[model samples]
Every structure is written in C-alpha cells, then in structure tokens.
Target: MDIKKIAVIAGDVIGPEVVSEGVKVMKKAAEIDGRISFEFTYFPWGCEFYLEQGKMMDEDGVCPA
Candidate 1:
C-alpha cells in the first residue's frame, strides 16, 4: 500500500500554530493505522511577507499549488 501525501499551506501569524496541531493529529492517525503516511508542508506567507515584498500574495500574483 502506498501512503498518501498531505500538503498544507499556512499563512503567517496563527497559521503556523493551527497547522502544527493539524499535523500532530495526522501523525497520530498514521501511527494508529500503522500503514498510512503523510507529508506535511507549511508555507509562511502573510502580512509580514507582504510588507517585505511590498504586496500581498495576491498582488505578487504567485499561484498557489
């Protein structure tokens, strides 16, 4: 059986905290199943990044995966 991949894109601020909890839950589930697996990815792009970049993610027009 092949394990599925899980991609999570979270903005800055509370986004990281929230996503961290979610990843913990998924990891627990994978352990219980003893087969399923997941790959979690968090992207920190929010107000701070926008301020530095001089634009919101939308303004940058970078497409999200």
Candidate 2:
C-alpha cells in the first residue's frame, strides 16, 4: 500500500469540528478500500493564534527545509 501525507491546519473552533468529520470520512473510506494510508500532520495556525501571537503561522506557514 502507498502512503499519503496530509497537512491539516484546523484554523478556528469551527474549523476543527469540520476537519474532524472530514478525517472520519477519509478513514472509513480507506478502511473499505484496504489500500493507501494517510499521515496527517496538524498545524496550529489560525485566527486565534494570530490574535495571541500576531501571526497566523510561523513565517506564513511554509515548512522549512
């Protein structure tokens, strides 16, 4: 089976709720297919973070090399 990487930024309170449902559906679909797998990396970047830190993400959410 192949592996897939998914970067998730659950922005605000409502964003998390929506992202959870999406993750659930994807997991169920994967189970039925019995194929590719997913690796999710959650980034805590959003309006709330901005309000506290004055930025939505670190360096505009670009992953460093």
Candidate whose lDDT is highest: 2
Per-prediction TM-score: 0.62, 0.82
Steric overlap count per candidate: 0, 0
Tens-place lDDT digits, model 2, residues 1-65: 87788988886666899998898888888888889778888888888888989977888578665
As a TM-score, model 2 comes out at 0.82
The list of candidate 2 runs beyond 4 A from truth reads none
lDDT of 1: 0.71
Model 1 clash pairs are none
Residue pairs in steric clash, candidate 2? none
lDDT of 1 by residue, 11-57 (tens): 66557779888889989989988878887654546788678876765
Candidate 2: minimum summed lDDT over ten consecutive residues — where?
56-65
